[model samples]
Target: MGSQAPGKGAKGPRILNVNVGVLGHVDSGKTSMVAALSTKLSTAALDKHPQSKERGITLDLGFSSFSVPLPAHLQHLPYDELQFTLVDCPGHASLIRTIIGGVQIIDMMVLVVDITKGLQTQTAECLVVGEVATSNMVVALNKCDLVPAEERPKAIRKAQKRLAQTFNLTKFAGVPMVPITAKPGGGGTGTSAAPDAEGLEELQAHLVAMVPTQPRALAAAGPLLFSIDHCFPIKGQGTVLTGTVLQGAVAVGDTIELPGLKLSKQVKSMQVFKRPVTKASQGDRVGICVTQLDPSLIERGLACAPGTVPTFNGAVAAVEKIRFYAGQVPSKAKFHVSVGHTTVMASLTFFGLPDGQGVSQEAALVQMIENLGRMALTGVPMPFDKSRDYVYQGALVIGAKFDGDIHGESCRLAFYGRLVTLINPSKPAELQQLRVYKMKEKRGVIERINEDQGNAIVRGMFKKETDPAIYTGLRVVTGRGEDGVIESSFGKSGKLKVHFAKGIQQAGRSSSDNAVILRCKRYINEHDRKRLRQ
Candidate 1:
């Protein structure tokens, strides 16, 4: 029944939704670089807010998209047939946790290095992280334009050579390093916005060749990993879950198998961008509506779906110990771990090796004990189990000696036995028009910022009186700033309160008004201004 996903209800030529992440040292221009990769102009161009500009650091993740025009050979394919979502990850040491978080969910990735600066400490660290976590990678020798014409190619070469010699990133063994500037390309001054268009085109062709138009085959079927990266509610609509499809597909009424985060909600609706769609395919990013959950339950890095996907128990005998590299958080460690969107409290218990051979001793037996919780399980060799926790324990996974290796041979998710391969929606005309319009609209550019956290803006039309989606969407987006009583409560009072400035007041503004939403910029950030202008 399953050969390859046939083009059944496709809206365009076979569409492959590819999500690529940028990893590099701080200030290596990961964000600026992605802005250049987009098909349209983006405000990430001026993200140099006072705080970020002052420190030259990207605190949160930034997102943008662009379409890879099919090769002249594939042009006959719908123009928007192949779309790519690029996530710009932070490179700052302080945000190492967040940076690595980006790699956990992506498929293929691009590593950006400043040609002029070569690879820094984090670049090397990021390489090792990728080697251990992902298999496909490409390097972008950013700022070739910074070097003298005679020196640029050599600079790019040195960087490429470094990838092999330094980190031994064999997965990207023969991958070419393209040189260009992210500042202009990131759409700042529009410098090389196309970033050596020909080279980029060649790179895309190479990627397509490597990614193979088929989903990577796995052992079992049924459970799908839906990594939630972004979430928002449409005015009259309910909540939407957006993320790259790690594995599996979803049709109008299909049940999802996201075992790790313990979510088993039925999909209410599905869409690509804002356009309605009947199905979602693997390796694609989609916004799905789900039932039976508070918006708070959904956060970034959440793996979810309906029914039993897989699960591992607190007492998975094979486990030895879990630890991170030096300078990594928690000397002894204690915190929450997530599978899909499910958060579980876990305690770090070091075990296995006796502390001789190398980083991780070669032995398997209880070494130390760290207390963990029920809802959340500690990180093991593979993806977490469903609510019940039945993750298969394997030798390679348990055998591997790493202070902390997120995967093990035994840890794997089940593939859905029956499937509906979505023909890439064949909506070229629709894609291009939307790209042009969306590229111009600039929505996420404002108060609502990085959705991995709470929303800053409350978007809804005010009525003289009557029903509101808030009744449906709820005042869910309300809540407080990074601090205050708001975090403690939701919906009615406590944390959800917003104080409106006297000069600017909503008609229904309650009598008391000083707090004015702890959310959104007090003086209005550039993004807010843009939304206002729009």
Candidate 2:
């Protein structure tokens, strides 16, 4: 069932909500545009944060929505009313985590750009985030009235051309651009004071036209997963959690679990924009009230059906490096990983199939990983299967230039991936199953050879404190093309005895400077274990 509109037993038309993210650089008029278009404001809408009003910039994600009657093309859909929930994301560079969190819930995006400034740093970053997060987007060239009347058209065209060139390498190439004056005369008290917004009607029409093309399956059958963005207390009523219903439906009196705190509470009541709703489905933005929970504990987190979400300490994912990032993505490098609304420091281990060895195997694995990534980008969940084997990559170097000037200021999005395996502390065996490895090789010269015993003492391969037992039973090759195996430690010092299967060659015995090389694969997790012990 769909959420009810604001009224008492009036039985208004069923609501179909589409979340649209407003993102751009700081002071790009994203909030102004949202304020102009939104007809209804939620409790947390329009600079609700004290710092936002004080600093004259948005410091957090703001919410406001407007409703439009269902267009004729979408009449065959399930719902009769269309609501666009505007998610105004912060544009400051420091608040990119918030923008990432907000973009996760959006069905599409309206990227606001300052007409004069064109695409700034955060604007480019927001475009990158949009490329990874959502599939559909429309650019809003805001602040058109700032330019002279005669020069407005030329300036807008120049900005559009620059934006087109920027998007040429991205998936959002050729997306529609609408010039608008979100706030005329550079200031306005509210939407009522600024009624003559340039291109407002045209922008609205473009949004409506794109609505029918959006892919939405509002089936409310899966386990309920609500992304709580705002939490507050209602005095005697209870604590209310306001967020979008990402998956499944939630009804009043049903129990939902706060996965972060590992606590479950009954849903006392629910509302959609001040209207009492008995039930709400996927894509609905609603506030749920429950008793006895402190509002301060959870500012942003996931609320879901009990036992549905699992906590993992580490995860293995199929990853591809971002082309814009110039730095090297070495394995085990730490990065800020944003999962849903939470951003945490995570050490990534990258792996893939060895080239030229497995043709069919590589094709199948790549296809599977690509499918998983596509499904995830579209907000679909595809569980990682443990039955399949994944290839291990020593490092992710594809599409990267090591010879170029790597210190340039650019987007630091090194790579993105879809989860393949989750490592839980409680399940130690899961970590043991990871077979990622790095190749290690050591070179030493054969100092002395025992012709009678058919063994040679190899030195110079390791330091004095190095353990020779680790290389025991490993194959070694000589400079003269002779193959042998490391027999055992010769003495307390770092020396090993090498034994040839067919017996030491005549060249090996005559030349004491024959070089011996040992090659072995070292697992990365084992290296981590050794470092931890140190």
lDDT of 2 by residue, 299-333 (tens): 88888888887655555665666666656665545
| Cα lDDT over the full model 2 | 0.72
Q: How well does candidate 1 match the true structure, expressed as C-alpha RMSD?
A: 26.8
lDDT per model vs. reference: 0.46, 0.72
By TM-score, how accurate is candidate 1? 0.54
Model 1 residue 510 lDDT?
34
Clashing pairs in 2: 351-393, 352-392, 352-393
Per-candidate TM-score against the hidden true structure: 0.54, 0.74
Candidate 2 ranges beyond 4 A from true positions: 1-10, 188-193, 212-214, 354-409, 425-428, 439-534
